[model samples]
Structure formats: structure tokens, C-alpha cells
Target: MPGRLQHKAALITGAGSGIGLESSLLFASEGANVLLIDVNVQAAEKVQKLIAERYPNVKSAAIKADVSKESDIKAAVDKAVELFGRLDVMFNNAGIMHPEDDNALNTEERIWDLTMNINLKGVWWGCKYAILAMRNNPTDASKGLHTGGSIINTASFVAIMGAATPQLAYTASKGAVLAMTRELAMVHAREGIRLNSICPGPLKTPLLMDFLNTTEKRERRMVHLPMGRFGEAIEIAQGALFLASDESSYITGTDFAVDGGLSSCYVTATGEPTLPPPSSLA
Candidate 1:
């Protein structure tokens, strides 16, 4: 049998590491031609080479692009179309959590602007161009490929729930992403397009790990996790895969939380999880 995303084209931002890297590999494994976009050209190229070797039948390429720059986003989307003939999935997953980002009084204007530029504005540009490209996607009924595509923005659990340890700008930016995704999903509901934000809890990725560097910092958030463990990047990738594929055809405009019950918990249980975290493919 063919893979879930066989013959589909996907463009992923921040493909160098963390959730983006895992998603790129997973998407390729499922037979989607992938365009990996990242500021780190070397990292993106490494993933592209791995995809070429592992999933030889699927086309994969890497491009150096900063998600904060609109032109770069447009170029990446256009490249996906040029390579795969259409864009079926756009994962606007690139974002940052500045170490300096803290409470309103402590966070600097530069930090705020930088976080918003990449986290919020970058997602906006990705959605804007992806929609334009997806609008003209060539339909192929036999393969289940359609004109409209799915867009997944990486939001955070903090967007929906408040965090005592504040990364104010990061939280605010993600909240905006959730809102933007909802409105866009509504606007394009009739156009066969789908938009949804995937909200992830604290993960063992480099991004969050760096921020929670000290043991005190780590424990501060750990006390609240019902699972008693940080999530893996691959876990979020699985959620992105479902949203990208037709399996989630009925889902759109929703805040799909892949959090480990973090958002829903009032008081976390005290034990560690028996099940092991999902292993990374990258």
C-alpha cells in the first residue's frame, strides 16, 4: 500500500532541528517530497541528504531561509512548487524563545520584536504564501491529492494557559498564532484549505532545554507536568503528520494541543510515566 502522504509536497520551516527536523524525516518516510527551510543551511542540507538516502523515491531539498523574512518564505514556497509541482503542506514551525525573554518589566524591546518577528510574523508569511501556492495546486483524485492544503503553525501550551515562569513575548506571540490560525481557517473554509495550530508542551528539544538550563528552572516547570517528563520532538511530529495528511480532513481552525495534559491539569500527579518517550528519527 502507498504511504499516507504519498506524492504530496511539504515545506517545513526550522527543519534543522527539534520538532521541525523530526517532522521532515517523518513526512519523507510517509512519501511526501519535502522542502526543508532553515537559516542553518548545513543542517538543512544534512537532513535533505538523509532523506535522499533513506527515502530514495521521494524528492527532498534544502534551502537557506530565515522565517522572519517574508521574501525568504515566499521563495521557499515557490521552490516547493517548482520541485513538486504543488504545495500540499506548509509547516510553519520555526520559532524562538529568547533566554532574555521574561516578564514585561524585564524583557527588552529588542527581545520582544525579535520573538514576534520570527514567531508571529514568520508564521503569517508562511500562511500567506502557502495559501497562494495551494490555491492553484493541481488536483489528482487517484492519489487523493487536492487543490487546497493544510497549514500547521507551532504554538505553545502557554498560549492557552498562563505560565508562572514568564516568557511574555513568546507567550503573546503564540497566542496570536492561535488566533490567526482560527481566523484564516474560517476565511478559507470554502476554498478547500485548512489551517490549524499545534500547541506543544515543554519538550526535550534544544530550544526549551536551553531556556530551562538550571535544575531549579527545569524543576520549576516539571512539577506541573502530569506526565512527569518533557515531551520528545517526534511526538509533536506525529501530530503534525496527522494534520498534514488527509486523516485529519475534518479538522481545521482548531488548537490541536499535543501537550501531555499540561493545559488541562490543575494539579499534576507525582509519579513518572511508565511508557518511554518516542524516539527521534533524525
Candidate 2:
């Protein structure tokens, strides 16, 4: 049987590590041709090689690009079309959680700008170029190809809920992403394109691990997780997979929260989770 994303083409930013890396692998496993974009070209190429070895039938390539730059993002999208013949899915997963991004009073202007550039503005650019490419996508009924595509932006649970230990800039940027996704989805609903945001909870990714360096800092957020454990990158990647596939054809304009119930919790339960976290490496 063919995979869910059979014959489709996907472009994922921040493909070097964390959720982006996991999503790229997962998309390829599901039979989509993948273009991996990241500032760390070597890291992306490493993933490209792994995908080639594991999913030999799928096409995959890596390109060095900074999401914050409009030209770079446009080139990445163009590369996808050039290499794969169409753009079926765009996963704007590149983002930063600067260690110094604290509450507004403590966070500097530079940090705020940096966070918005990568997180908010980056998603915007990705969506813009992806839509342009998707509009001209050639129709191939036999292959289930269409003129429009699915776009998934990486928001955060913090965008919906408050964090006492605030990374104000990160939270605000994510909120903007959610809003932008909703409006775009509405605007493009008439067209075949669909737009949505994925809101991930605190995960054990390098980005969050670096911020929650101390046990005290880790525990502070852990206390609010009903799962009593941080999430995994694979978990979020699974969510992205659903959004990218035709399985979610009717789903659009919503914040798909794969947050381990973090957004729903007022007070977390005391017991530990019986289920172990899933790993992409596994």
C-alpha cells in the first residue's frame, strides 16, 4: 500500500534538529519528497543522507537558509518546486527560544526582535511563498495532485496559556502565528489551500532543554503538565504528519494542540504517566 503522503512534496524549515528534523524524517517515511532547510547546512545534509538510506525511494535534499530572511525562505520554496515538481506541504517549524528571553522588563529589545524575526515573521514569509508556489501547482488527477497545498506553522502552548516564568517575546510571537494562520486559512478557504498552526507543549528538545537548564526551572514547568513529563519531538512530528497528509483534508484554521494536555490543565495530577515518551530515533 502506498503511504499517506505518497507522491507529495514537502518543505520543512529548521530541519537540522528537534521537531523540524523529526517531521522531515516522518514526511519522507510517508512517501513525500522532502526539502530540508536550515541555517546549519551540514546538519540538514546529514538528515538528507539518512532519509536517502532509510527511505530510498523518496527524494530528499538539504539547503542552507535562514527563515528570518524573506529571500532565503522564497528560495527554499522555489527549490522544492524545482526539485520535486510541486509543493504539497509547507512546514514552517524554524524558531528560537533565546535563553535571555525573559519577562518584558528583563528581555532586551534585541532579543525581542530576534524572536519575532525567526518565529513570527519567518512563518509569514513561509506562508507567503508557499501559497504563491501552491497556486501554480500543476494538477495531476491520476497522482492525486492539486493546485493548492497544506501549510503548518509551529506555534506553542504558551500562545494559549500563561507562563509565570515568562518568555514574553516567544509567547507573543506564537500568539501572532496563531492569529495569522486563522486569518490566512479563512482568506484562502475558497482556494484549495489549507493553513493551520501546531501548538506544542514543553518538549525535551534542545531549545527548551537549554532554557530549562536547572532542575528548579524544569520542575516549575513540569508541575503544570498533567502527563508529569515533557513531550517528545516525535509527538509533535506526528501532529504535523496528520496536518500534512490528506487525512486532515477537512481540518484547517485551528490550533492543533499536541500539548500533552498542558493547555487544559489548571492543576496537574500527582501520579506519573505510565506511558513512556516516543522517540524519533526509535
Best by lDDT: 1
Worst 10 residues of 1 by lDDT: 266-275
Q: What lDDT does the true structure give each of the candidates?
A: 0.94, 0.94
User: What digit string (tens of lDDT, one per residue) describes model 1 on residues 98-210?
Assistant: 99999989999999999999999999999999999999999989888889999999999999997758899999999999999999999998999999999999999889998
TM-score of candidate 2 versus the correct structure, residues matched by position = 0.98
Q: Residue 183 lDDT in model 2?
A: 99
Candidate 2 wrongly placed segments (more than 4 Å):
none
* Every model: Cα RMSD to truth: 0.8, 0.9
Instruction: Return the number of clashes found in candidate 1.
Output: 0
Q: Model 2 Cα displacement at 17 (Å)?
A: 0.4
Tens-digit per-residue lDDT, 1-282, candidate 2 = 899999999999999899988999999999999999999999999999999999999999999999999999999999999999999999999999999999968999999999999999999999999999999999999989999999999999988886756799999999999999999999998788999999999999899999998889998898888888899999999999999999999999999999889899887868878678874652
Worst 10 residues of 2 by lDDT: 273-282
What local lDDT score does residue 99 receive in model 1, on the 0 to 100 scale?
95
